[model samples]
Target: MDVDDGRTARARPSSWAAVAIGTVAVIWLAFWVLKAVFDVVALLFAGVLLAVFLHGIAGWLSRRAHLPAGWALAVTVAAIVAVLGAGVWLIAPSLAAQVDELSQRLPEAARRVADHIERYAWGRRLVERLSEAQGLPQARQALLGATRLLSTTLGALTGVIVVLFVGLFLAAEPAAYRRGLLRLVPIARRARAATVLDDTGHILRRWMLGKFCSMAAVGVLTWIGLSLLGIRLALALALLAATLTFIPYLGPVLALLPAALLGLLQGPAMAGYVIALYLGIQLVESYLLTPLIQRSTVALPPGLILAMQVLLGALTGGLGVVLATPLLAALVVLVKRVYVEDVLGDATVDQGEGAPLPGLPEQR
Candidate 1:
């Protein structure tokens, strides 16, 4: 009996070791699987954000115009399409011309920059280091990278079409989708899940509203400022600035690069003035516009947002960086509602109020 007992103990340890190995293997496989699907998941999340925007507008139209939800949503979509189509039709030619000019001028601008840098001893050293970095192999790698980027851009265009369709479908029947999602949860926890979903949607909607307002303000201000500065391709630069403003910290820096390069083409004084204009615009947007617009929304810490952008950009490239802020915002909501309040028993955390989710009851 003692011998049998010893044998059983030894067997148990082997079994436990096997289990641990299996668990580790499963985790490694899951990680790879998730990495593979991460881009698809990000695209779906982008569609969700678009849906939120559409639904929010439809809700407002429903309330104000006394229209049925479906009709309101249809009107909202039509209006958006019309506005976009009209804007494109009106501005595409001029914008295209400016974009072409900007592209042609940028190479010259870069050369001018290199010449200026060669003037100072420290700048010469910097240029030498840069040149050294851009060896034959590095140049080959850059060509390959550009090729990959072009392919990725094509893929992204397809993804945008998918996102648009997904958004339209989701906005059309938000309740059905919400119910389907909740059905995945256990009956006992489904109510809580619904609440969390509603809160997340509300928060996302507010963020979108604030972001649109900020983008418009930045675009208009940039165009005005660049025009006054006599900067060539002001329209293209303004458009670029407005679009990049969607990505937060890294975006502004990127937008500034082209504008600054263009300014450098003009002269050192113009470059300085261009830099000051961008800085002033950023200041006003960060301090004044955002605070007033997003007062009722949850304020994300700038540091956290920047960190997330860097991490995601490294992991998943441009799409990751573009979607990082909204993804982080949704994550914050989930952590607060699910982990902090539910798991940690800290129910006092204030979840900022916003527009009620299209099909969810308002939580008082």
Candidate 2:
């Protein structure tokens, strides 16, 4: 008996170690496979986020205006399209002209930039270093590489229409679909499940509203500031700023690049004015607009936001970054409420305050 018992005990550690090693290896393989799959579905994720955003707005309009939910959703979606159309109409001509002009002038800019590099002291040293490392003749090769990136950007544009259509469908039928989904939950847990759904919608709605307002404010301020500074491509630049504002810190900085570069091309005085204008716009956005828009929503920690962006971007590139925050925030709420508070919870803590939930009337 003692011999058999000793053998079993000796084998247990080896068995546990084998299981652990096997689990980790399986997990690693699954992670890579999942990343590849996620890349394909990344756009659908963006569509879902958009649907969540529009769905919440639909609910608010339905409740407040006493409109049919479908009609409210239709109205909201139409308003978005109208604003986009109007913006395009206002800027289309100038944007086309600017693109044509840019296509023509870019070569000249490249030549000038090259000439400046050859003439400038710091640029000369950097060129020598790059030449040593890459064995390339000149930095013009790098410029050409950048132009190819613009061509590839057109491919990303193709996904836009697909996402738009998906978003529309989601906006139209969110509630019916969401209810159907909740049917999978056990009857006893349905009330808690419903609360989770409601809270998710609220969090998503507040986030969307806040982002929309912030983007609008930033766009308007950017346009007015750049225009006042006599910066070229003011309208196109403004729109870019607004669109990029969805991206957080990186977006505003990207908007600044064009405005500042154009200002530099104009002269030092124009550049100085452009810098000051942007500074003022930043102040207004940080102090005024953000507070007003975010009043109803909790601010996410900056480090977590950046970390989520990088992680999502690694898995899905651009689309991941677009949907990261709202998804994570909703998930955070779900985790705390469902897993921590409800599932593996301390019953005594809640029992001290109110009657047990199970005994209460279902309607309450």
Which of the numbered candidates is closest to the native, going by highest TM-score?
Answer: 1
**Residue pairs in candidate 1 whose N, alpha carbon or C atoms collide under 3 angstroms:** none
Q: Residues 205-277, candidate 1: write the lDDT tens digits.
A: 9998999889999999999999999999999999999999999888889999999999998788999999999
- Could you give candidate 2's per-residue lDDT for residues 17-79 as a string of tens digits? 999999999998987887889855767766777888888877888899999988998898888
Question: What TM-scores do the predictions have?
Answer: 0.84, 0.75
Off by over 4 Å in 2: 1-27, 99-122, 128-158, 343-364
Q: What lDDT score goes with residue 121 in model 1?
A: 100
True-structure RMSD for candidate 2: 7.3
Instruction: Give the worst 10-residue stretch by lDDT in candidate 2.
Output: 346-355
Residue 25's C-alpha lDDT in candidate 2? 97
Each model's Cα RMSD = 6.7, 7.3
